[model samples]
Target: MFIVMVAPECAPVAKAGGLGDVVFGLSHELEIRGHAVEIVLPKYAGMRYEDVWDLQPSHHDLWVPWYDGTVHCTVWFGYVHGRKCFFIEPHSQDNFFGRERMYGYDDDALRYAFFCKAALEYLAASGKRPEVVHCHDWHTGLLPVLLYEQYAQVLGDQRVCYTIHNFCHQGLTSPEVLWATRLGRVDHFLAQDRLGDDTHHGAVNPMKGGVVYANFVTTVSDTHAAEARYGDSACGLGHTLHRYQDKFGGVLNGVDYDVWNPETDPYIPAPYSASTIERKYLNKEALRERFMLRKSWSPLVAYVGRVDEQKGMHLVHHALFRTLAAGGQFVLMGQEQKHNGINGHFQHLKDHLNNNPDSHLELSYQEELAHLVLAGADLLVVPSLFEPCGLIPLMAMRYGTVPVVRATGGMRDTVFDRDHGEHADDRRNGYVFQHTDNQAIDSALQRAFGLWTDYPEDFRSLMLNGMRADHSWHRPADHYLDIYEHIRHK
Candidate 1:
C-alpha cells in the first residue's frame, strides 16, 4: 500500500505535541511493514533542519488556489527518520508558515486551510494516487474536503482516514474562507451537515467537514470515541459523530519505544529494565539531588505536561499538597500559555512551596529533563478532566512508574486499576479514578501511596506489570493498516 500522511507536525522535526509523534511513529511502522509511506508537512520556519536528510527542492513552482488569487509554493523533499518527506514552502507576502511557532496564531484557520489545498495540489501535480491520505488533527482537516470536492479527478480514488487527536480544536472559521479551497458552490459547504459549525452559526468547521467527507474517522481511543459520539467532548460535533457512527471509531495511539525505552535512554543518569528494577532507585536518588528535594526514601511523585485547565490543573495543585501531606515528594515540570493566566498561578504555588523541601516546580518543558523526571519518579499522576490519548502515562508505565490517572480517554484503555479492574489480579497496572474533583484524585493517590509504602512486593509487581506490557506502535500501526485496507475496498 502507498500511504501519504498530510499533517501539520511530525516528531524530531516539527513537533508541537503527540500528533507529531503519532505521525512519525505510525508512518515508520507502516514503512517497516513493507508499505510505501510518505509524509507531507508545511515548511515551518522553526523546524529542526538537522533531523532532515538530503534536504533539497523537489518542485520549483507549484501554484495553489487561494482566496481571490493563487499562491506559488516551493516543495522540498527530504528523508526524516528514514521516511520520505515533502515540505511545502509557500512564496507569498503573507508568510503563512514563516512564523516562529507551529501553531497558535491569529490566522491559524486560514493558514491551515491554505495548507490543505496546497498539499492536495502537490499530490495532484506529483501524479500520486495513494491508497490512503491520512489527515491528522484540525490542521489538515480541510484536506479530506478538498480531496473529494475539488481535486477528485486529478487525485483519483484516494481514501481519506481522518484522525481527530482532540475534538476541542475544530478549526472554526468564517464560511467565506471556503473560497480559498476553490471548492465549487460555497453555499453547499455552508449546509449544516457538511462544513457548518454547529455551535458557531454562520461559520464553517474544517474538522466537521473531515468527519462528514472522509471514508473513515478515528479518535485516539475507544473511550474517547464514545465520549465524542455520546458525551460532550466533541465540542458540538457529537451529533455529527453520532450521524456518522458507522464510519467513525477509535484506535489507541502508540508510543515510540525507540525514543522512550528506559533501558537505552541516554537522558537519564541510570538505565534500568524490568529485570534490573532495583537500579531504578539510583535514578531516584540522582533526581532528588538534581531537584534539590530532601534526601529521603519517600515515594517521588511527578507530573509532566502543560499547566492548563484541560489538564485539570486544579487537581494537580491539590494533588501536590495532598502528596506532601501523605509524606511523599512531588516534582512538576510543565509550561503554561501566558495568555491563560495559569502560569502565574503555578508560579505562585512555586513561591508558596519554596520553603518546602519535598516539592520542586519547573514552569517550562525541557525534553531531556522530562526523560529524567519520568525515569526517576516512583509514581506519575495525570488527573486530566478529559484526555484524548495521553502518551505521558504510557511512557511512565514503560519506565515502570505506576500511573494514577482519571478513567478517561486512552488512560482508561491503557491503565487498569490495581484493585478495581475486572481482571485486577492479571490486568492491573496502575491506579484509577473517575471524577474531576480533588477528592477523587486524592483517593486514587492515597491508594497508590498505601501500596507503595506497605506492600513493597505488590508495588514491585504492579510496576513490573506495566513494564512488561506492550505499548509500542506495532499494534496500532497494524490497526491503521486494516482501516486503510477496509476503506480502499469500500
Candidate 2:
C-alpha cells in the first residue's frame, strides 16, 4: 500500500504534543510492514533541522493559490524515522509557519489552510497518488476537502482517512477564511452537514468537513469515539459524528517502544526490565537526588504533561497536596499555557513549597526529565478531565510505573483498575477513577499508596503486570492498515 500522511507535526523534528508522536509512530510502523509510507509536513522555522536526513529542494517554485493571488512554495524532501517526508516551505510575506513556535498564533486557521493547499500542490506536481491520504487533526482537516473538491483531477480519487486526535480544537474560523484554501464558498460546500459550523453562525469547521468528506474517520480510542458521538466531549460535534456513525470509529494510539522502552532508554540513570525490576530503585534514588528531594521509602508519585483545564490541572493541584498528606513524595514536570490561570496557581504553590524536601514542581517540559520521572516514580498520575488518547500512561507502564488515571477516552481502554475488572488480578496494570473530582482521584491514590506501603509484594506484582503489558505500535498499526484496506475497497 502507498500511504501518505499529511499532518502538522512529526516527532523528533517538529512536535507540539501526542499528535506528532502518533504521526511518526504510525508512519514508521507502516514502513516497517513493507508499505511505502511518506509524510508531508510544513517546514516550520522552529523544526529540528538536524533530525531530517538528506533534506534538499524537490521543487523550488511550486505555486499555491492564496486568497486573491498565488504564492510560490519550496518543496523539500527528506527522510525522518526512516520514512520519506516532504516539507512545504512557503515563501510568502505572511510568514505562515515562520514563527518561533509550532502553534498558538493569531493566523493559525489561515496558515493551516494554506498548508493544506500547498501539501496537495506538492503531491500533485510530484506525480504521487497515494492509496491512503491520511489527514491528521484539524491542521490537515482541510486536506480532504481540497483533495476532493479542488485537486481531484491531478491527485486522483484517493481515499482519505481523517483521524481526529483532539475534537475540542476543530479549527473554527470565519467563513471568509475559506478563500485562503481556494475552496470557494459554494452552497454545496457550505451546507450544514458539510463544512458549515452549525453551532457558530457564519463559521467554517474544518474538522467537521474532514469527518463528512473523508471515507473513514477515527479518533484515538473506542471509548473516546463513543464519547464524541454520544457525549459532550466532542465540543458540539457529537451530532455531526453521530450523523456519520457508519464511517466513524476509534483505534487506540500506541507508544513507540524504540523511544519509550526502559531496557534501552539512555535517559534514565538505571535501565531495568520486568525481570530485573529490583534495579529500578537506583533510578528512584537518582531522581530524588536530582530533584533535591529527601530520601524516603514512601511512594514517589509523578505527573508529567501539559498543565491545563482539560488536563484536569485542578485535580493535579489537588493530587500534589494529597500525595504529601498521604506521606508520599510528589514530583511534577509539566508546561503551562500562559492564557490559563493555572500557571499562577502553580507558581504560588511552588513559592509556598519553598523547596520542600518531599515535593518538587518544575513548570516547564524537559523531555529528559520526563523520562527520568517515568522511570523513577512508582506511580504516574493522569487525571485528565477528557483525554482522547494519552501516550504518557502507556509509556509510563512500559517503564513499570503503574498509572493512576481517570476513566476517560483511551485511559478507559488501556488502564484497567487494579481491583475492579473481572479478570483484574491478571489484567489490571494500574488504578482507575470514575469522576473528575479531587475525592475520586484521592480514593484511587490511597489504594495505590496502601498497596505499596503494606503489601509490598502485591505492589511489585502490579508493576510487573504493567511492564509485561504490550502497548506497542504493532497492533494499532495493523488496525490502521485494516482501515486503509477497507476504505480502498469501499
Candidate 3:
C-alpha cells in the first residue's frame, strides 16, 4: 500500500500539537509494516533544517495557482525519523509559508490553499499515485476537494480519507478564496450540505467541503465521533457529518512510547517502572525541589496543558485549591496564550500559587518539566469540557501516575474507575468523573486521594495497571490500515 499523508505538522520536526504526533506515529508505523509512506508539509521559516536528515532539493521552480495568479514554490525532500518527508516552500515573493510561525497568520487560508495546490502539482509532476490520500485537519481539508473537483483525472484513482482532529476550527474563510483552486464558482459550494454553514454566511467551510467529497471521515475517538454526529460539539458541521453517517467513524489516538515511556525516557531525572515504583518518589522529590514546593510526604497533584477554558481551566483551579486545602502539593506545567482573557486569570493564579508553600505553577512550555511532572506526580488531573483525544492522561498513566479525568471523548474511552467498572479489579486504571463541573472534579480528586492514603494496595494496583496498559500505535495502526483498505476496495 502507498499512502500520502498531508498535514500541517509532524512530530520531532515541525509540530504545533498532537496532530504532529499522530501524523508521525501513524506514518512511521505504516512504513514499518512494509507500506510506503510519504508526508507533505509546509516548510515554515521556523522549521529546524538540522532535524531533516539527508536534506536535498526535490523540486525547484514549481508553480501553483493562487487567487487570479500563479505562486512559484520550491519543494524540498528529506527523511525525518525514517519516514520520507517533503517540505513545500512558497517563493519569497508570495510569502505564504515564509513566516516564522507555523500558524496564526492573517493570510492563513491563502497559505494552506497554496500548500494544497502545490502538493497536488508535486504529485502530478512526479507521477506518484498513492492508494490512500490521508489528509489531517482543516489545514489539508481542501486537498480532497481539489482532488475530487479539479485534478481527478490527473491524480488517477486515489481515495481520500479525511481525519477531523478538531472540529471547532472549521477553517472558515471568504468564499473568494475558492478561486485559487480553479474548481468552479462559489455557488457550487454554497449549498446547505456543502461548504455553507449558517453561522458564517459569506465564509467557506473547508472541513464541510472535505466531508462532502472524501470517501471516509474519521474523528479522534468513537465517543467524539458520536458527539460530532448528534451533539453541538461538531461546531455547526453536525448536519454534514450526520448526513454521511455511514462513512464517518473514529480511531482513538495512540501514544508514542518512544517519547513517553518512563523506563527509557531521557527527559525525566529518575526513570522508574511499575516493578520499581518505589523509586518514583525520587522523581517526586526532584520535582518539588525544582518547583520550590514544600518537602513533605503529601500527595502531589499535577496538571499539564494550555491555560484555557476549553481545557476546563476553571475546574482545574477549583480542584487545585481543594487539593492544597487537603494537605497536598500541586504542580502545574502550562503556557498561557495572550489572546485568551482567561489566561490573565491563570497568570494571577500562578502568582498566588508561587507564593504558597505547597503549590507551584510554571507559565511556559517546558517539555522536560512535562515529563518530570507526569513521572513525579501521584495524580494527574485532566478536567476537559470536551476532549477529542487527550494524550496527557495516557502519558501520565504510563509513568505510574493515576489520572483523574472527566468522562468525555478519549478520556471516557481510555480511563476506568476502579470502583465503577464491571471488572473493577482487572480493568480499572484511573478515576472518572461524569459532570463537567468543580464538584465532579473534586469528587474524583477526593477518590484518588482516598485511594492513595487509605487503601494503599488498591492505589498501587491502579498505578501498576495503568503502567502495564496498552496505549501504543500497534492497534491504532491496524485500525487505520483497515480503514485504508476499506476505502480503497470501495
Query: Which segments of candidate 2 are over 4 A away from where they belong?
Result: none
Model 1 is weakest, by summed lDDT over 10 consecutive residues, at 175-184
Mind giving the per-residue lDDT tens digits that candidate 3 earns over 135-228?
9999888888888778888988889999999887878888767776776588868777677766888788888888988999999999999888
Candidate 2's TM-score reads 0.97
Task: Give the candidate number with the greatest TM-score.
Answer: 2
* Local accuracy of candidate 1 as per-residue lDDT tens digits, 1-490: 9999999999889876788889999998888889999999999999999889999999999999897789999999999878799999999999999997877787899899999999999998988889899999988888988888788888888899999999988889886677666674767888998998887888889899999999999999998999888889999999999999999999999998888989999998889999999989988988999889889879999999988888989999998999999899999998666467888999999999887899999988776788889989999999998999988999998998999999899898999999885865756899999999888998999899999999999999999999999999989988898899999999
Worst 10 residues of 2 by lDDT: 179-188
C-alpha local distance difference test of each model? 0.90, 0.90, 0.86
Q: What lDDT does candidate 1 reach at residue 474?
A: 87
- Taking all chains together, each candidate's TM-score versus the true structure is 0.97, 0.97, 0.96
Clashing pairs in 3: none
